[model samples]
Target: MHRGTNLPAVGGYNQALILDVIRRSGEGASRVELAEKTGLSAQTLSNVSRRLLDEGLIRESGKMVTGPGKPRTILRLEPEARFAVGVHLDPTVITYVVLDLEGHVVAHSRTRTPVGTKPEETIRRLTVSVNAIIETSGIDATRILGIGIAAPGPLDAEGGQVFNPPLMTEWHNVPLGASLAASTGLPVFVEKDVTAAVAAEQWMGALGDLKNSLFFYYGTGVGAGLVVDGAVVRGASSNSGDIGHLIVDPDGPLCRCGKRGCLGDSVAPVSLVLEAIEAGLVSAPTGELDSVTVDNDFTRLLSLADEGNGHAVVIVERAARRIARGVLAIVSILDVDRVVFGGPFWDRASRAYLGVVPGAVADDPALMMTHPIRFEQSKLGADVAAIGAGCLVLDRVLSPKPTDLLI
Candidate 1:
C-alpha cells in the first residue's frame, strides 16, 4: 500500500494515493478505511476527499454501518472521469483501444498494417485511425489523458524513436512518438510491444496478483515480457524482452540471423505457414506470401491441426515444443512461477500450444524451479497490448509512485 504525507507541498501525491486506494476498493471504501489503508490523517483524508469529490473523480455511495458509531459514507471511483488511448503497431495489424480510468477497454478498432509504405505515410494513416476511434467512441476530448503506442522492440524509448525493428522494414530510426504527438495534439509515449504486453497483463489481466511472471508474446514474432518483484523489467535500452534469437532447435528452420532453429524463426506465424506450405498442408498463394496471406494461412493451418491432420499437428506440436524450450531457458534464469500467453496470433495457437507447453516445461530434464509453475491465457484477449498501452496513460496519471513524493 502507498502511504500519504500531510506536507503542504505533497498534496497532489496524497490525493493520488487516496484515489488509488478508493479505485481498488471495488464496491467502495469509507473514509476510515482509506485512512487505515493509506495511513493518512483524518483531516488530510477529508481535504483530499473533498477535492476528489469536487473534481468529480469520486462519489459518495450509500452509507454502510459497521458498528454502533455513525454509518460511514462509502466512496467510489468515477471511472469515466478520465480516459486514455492505446495504439499497438504490429507488423501485420494496427490495434487501437480506448480505456477508462479503471483500465477497462471501452472501445477498440483494428486495421491491416500497410506493407512497403514509407514511415511518414504509415504514421499519417495511424493518426487518421486514432482520430476516427476517438470520434466514434464519443468520448469528451477534454477527458482523454494521452496516447500510448506499443511497437516492436529495439526502441529508443527515451527518445521516442523506433530504431529499426526487424519486422517493420520501413521504420528505420523513425521518431514515431513525436510524429504521432504532433499529428494528434496529445502527449505520446512509445514502448516495446512485449513490454507493453506485460504491462497490460499486470494492469488488467490475472497476473496482477502475482509478483513474478513471464508474458510469452506470440505475434508476427516471438518475445518474452518479464516481471520480477512486482515490476516490469525494462533493460538498459528498454528492449528487454527479445527472446527471439534463443536457439531452441538444432536442425529447425534457418533464421534471418543466419542461424537455424531460433525460437522466433521456428514458431512465428509466417514460419509456420511457410512450413505448412512446404509440407503440402496449405496451398501456396499465387503471389508473394504477405502478412495478410500468412495470417489467413496460419489460421487454416491451426484449423487443420484441430481436425487432427497428422502433418499439421506435427508442425504445431514441434513449434509448441520449441516455444517450451525457449520458455524453460528463461524461467530457469528468472525463476518466475507464472507464464502468460497472448498476442495477435495467440488465439489460433492457444489450444495446441497450451496442451504441449505446460507438459513439456514440467517434464524437461533441465527444469530448475522446485515449485510448480502456473500458466494462464490472457483474459484481455487479442487487444491486450493496446489496452495496456492505454493503461500507460492511466498508470502515469493515477498510480501512486514513490518518486512522486521526492522533495
Candidate 2:
C-alpha cells in the first residue's frame, strides 16, 4: 500500500487531468487537442492551462500552423518543473532513483544497508543518500514533490512502521515513513516493495493500461502485487501481496513459515541457489554459499543458465514450473487478465522463467475462468520498485482520479 498526502484536489483536479492529457501526447498538445482528450470545455481548458503555465508546470513549446487559421500554441509538460525520489530498502542493499515529471531516472545510487548497525544509522544513511542525489543532480530542491520508500512488508503502511519483515528483524516498527520525512525535510510515503513496483508498472510500464494484473516480484525474496479494478490491492493491513507464502507444492519442501512447499520455499533466490548447489550444478566450496551471498549466488547460477549450462537450465525450469503454479493461483483468485514478472533478479531469471512459466500457466485448468490472459516480461527492469516509489509521488500530486472529480 502507498499512502499519499498533500494533494491539491480542488480545481487542481481539472488541471491535473489536463496535464496528464498533455503528457500522454508526447511532443505537445494544442488547446483543442487537450480539450478533446481531457473532455474539458474550451473555457475550462483555457483557465486550467493559464493556471498551469502560471505555476510553471507547463510551457508553450512552439506553435503548430493550421491550413486556414492562425498558429495554435503547443503546450508541453515542464519535465524539470517537478521531481520525486524513490528508494528501495532491500535487506541486502538500498537503491535510490530520482525521477523527473516525465518518469525518467535522472540520477541513481546504490548502497549496502548497514544491517548490523543500529536502525537509526540505516535511516540516517538513507537520508544522506537521498540528499546526495538531489544535491548532485542539480535539480532544484523545491521542485521535488516528495520521497517514496519501498520496503519489505508485513508491516503497517498507514502507521508507517515495519514489523517483523523476514530476515531483517532490525527494522521492526521502525516508523520508516515519518523518520525519512523528518530526516529529508519532505513529505514521505511508504509502500510494500511489490506494491510499489506495481505502481511503477501502472504509471509507466508496458502493461500500464491494464486495469487488472499481477506483478510477480522476483527479488532477494519472492512476492506479488495485485491490481484490481485499476486500484492497487493493499489488503486490510496493507500487507496484501505476501504471495511468497502461498503453498504451491504440498509435498515438496518445508517453508520457514511452517508450510509445505510454499512459493518462496520453491523459487526464491536463496532457494534457487541452494537447489543449484544440491544438484551439483553449482560446485562452489562449502560454507561459501550462505545467507549473505544468496543474491550473488543466484545471479551466478542464472548467468550459467544463460550461457547454456544444461544443468543450470534444468534448475531454472524446475523453479519456473513451481513459480507458474503460484501465478496460476493468484490469477485464479483475482480473476485478473494479465500477469507481469519483475524485480531485481528478473533479468537474470527472465529468459528461463518466461520460457517455461507461460506454457505451464496456459496449460492450467484455471485458464478457462478468464479470457486469454496476457503474460509479459517486465520492461521496467531491476529498478521497478525504486521507479514505482518515485511514480507514487507523481501520482499523488498529478494523476487525476475519479475522486478528484467528485468535489
Candidate 3:
C-alpha cells in the first residue's frame, strides 16, 4: 500500500535474492541478520532491507531479544501487503484461489474448462475469471505478486507450457504461465498439480521442518510430490513425481502415458469406474464426475463403498492395493518419515487404502522394523495444493538460498 525505498541496482543483490533469504528465515530479518546470512556487507543489507521495508512487503515487529545493548526491533513480513493467485486446472474445471502472504485464501472463484474446447479459448475464460476474482477480492493490482497454475502435466515448467497430459489433450504446448502473466500483468509460475500440492505440504503442511518426506498424491490420477531437505525436487524438467508411470504390472492394461501396466492405468479413478461398469453397476462413461449425472464427487464414491456396492468395493479395494504397492515402493527408495496422502481422490482412497497401507509397509519384511514408517491423511484437505502453490510466491520473497551469494 506504500513505498518503502528504491531497489538495489538490478544486477546487484536484488529483491528475489534478498526476499529468498528472509523467507527461509521465517519472513523477517534484521539488517544485521540479512547481511550475515547473505554475506552482503552491512551497507548493502541496509539498502536492500530499506527498499523492501519501504515497499511494505516486510515490516518491523516489536523487538528481538538482543544480548546486552539496545533491544533490536524484529523484522517480519507484512503478509497483507501482497497476495498470490493459485489456479488448480484439471480437465474437470479451473479453481482459482487468492492467498495472502500467510497462505490464507482471501477470495476464490471457479469455472469449467469446457471439455474438448480449444486451449486458447479455455485460458481466455480463465483470464476473465482471474480478472473477476481480483475485482471481487478488492485487492490492489500492485499488491498481487503473480498467478501460479497447478495443472495436470507433462509440463515444460521453465517454458511455462503444458505438454499433452491425457485428460487435457487440447492443451498441447499451451503457454499457461506466459499467457496468464501477459494477461494479468503479473509473473506466472506453472507446476504440475500434484507437485504443487507437495510443495505446499513441504512449505506449510504436516511436513513442517522434516528433511525428507514423500507425499502420496491421490487424485483423478495418482502421482506424488517429493520434498527433499526443504526443497521441492524437480526432475530435469520440473516433473519428478510422475510416479503414476511406475509399472506395478507389466502385463496390465495400457496406460495413457503409453506404458502398459503403469500405475495410472492400474490404480486411477477411471479404472475403479470401469470395474463398476464391468460388474453391471455403472452404466455410464467416466467423464468429470461433476459433468456426469451420477452424483459422484468422492462423497458418492465413498457412500457407494459404504453401502457395499459389490463392484464398487472390489474396484476401490483393488485400486487401493495398487496404490499401497506404489507407496511401499516410494518409501523403500526414499526412506521418508511419513507418507501423506491428499487430493480430490483422497476420500474414497482413504476408505480403500487406510486399512492396507501400513500393512504394505510392514510387509516390506525386506526392511528393518526397528522403526516403522508412519502414514497420514492431509489435514489441509482439498485446498492444500492451491494454497501451497500460492505460498510459492511468498517463499520466493522470503526463503534464501546459498546461490544468492554465488549468483
- Per TM-score, the best of the predicted structures is 1
Ranking by TM-score: 1, 2, 3
Q: What's the TM-score of each model vs. the native?
A: 0.97, 0.89, 0.85
lDDT of each candidate versus the true structure: 0.91, 0.85, 0.72
Which residue pairs show collisions in model 2?
A: none
Root-mean-square deviation of every model: 1.2, 3.8, 4.4
Model 1 misplaced regions, further than 4 Å:
205-208
Score candidate 1 by TM-score against the native. Answer: 0.97
Off by over 4 Å in 2: 1-9, 35-44, 65-68, 283-292, 306-311, 401-407
Cα distance off (Å), candidate 2, residue 192: 1.4
Model 3: per-residue Cα lDDT over 1-407, one tens digit each: 11122334442335656665555567477776766656666676677678888888778887777799777666776768889988888676577889987677888776766877898888888899988898899998788888888888799877889988887667778888888888778888888888888888776645466467788877667778887766677788888888878877677678767778788778766665555656766565555444433225344555677788776676667666677778778877777767788876675568567877677667765555366677888776767677667876666655543354452
The candidate, 1 or 3, that scores higher on lDDT is 1
Tell me the tens digit of each residue's lDDT in model 2 across 44-127. Answer: 778889999999999999999977788899999999899999999887778999999989999999887775677899999998
What is the lDDT, from 0 to 100, of the residue 322 in candidate 2? 90
Q: Of 1 and 3, which scores higher on TM-score?
A: 1
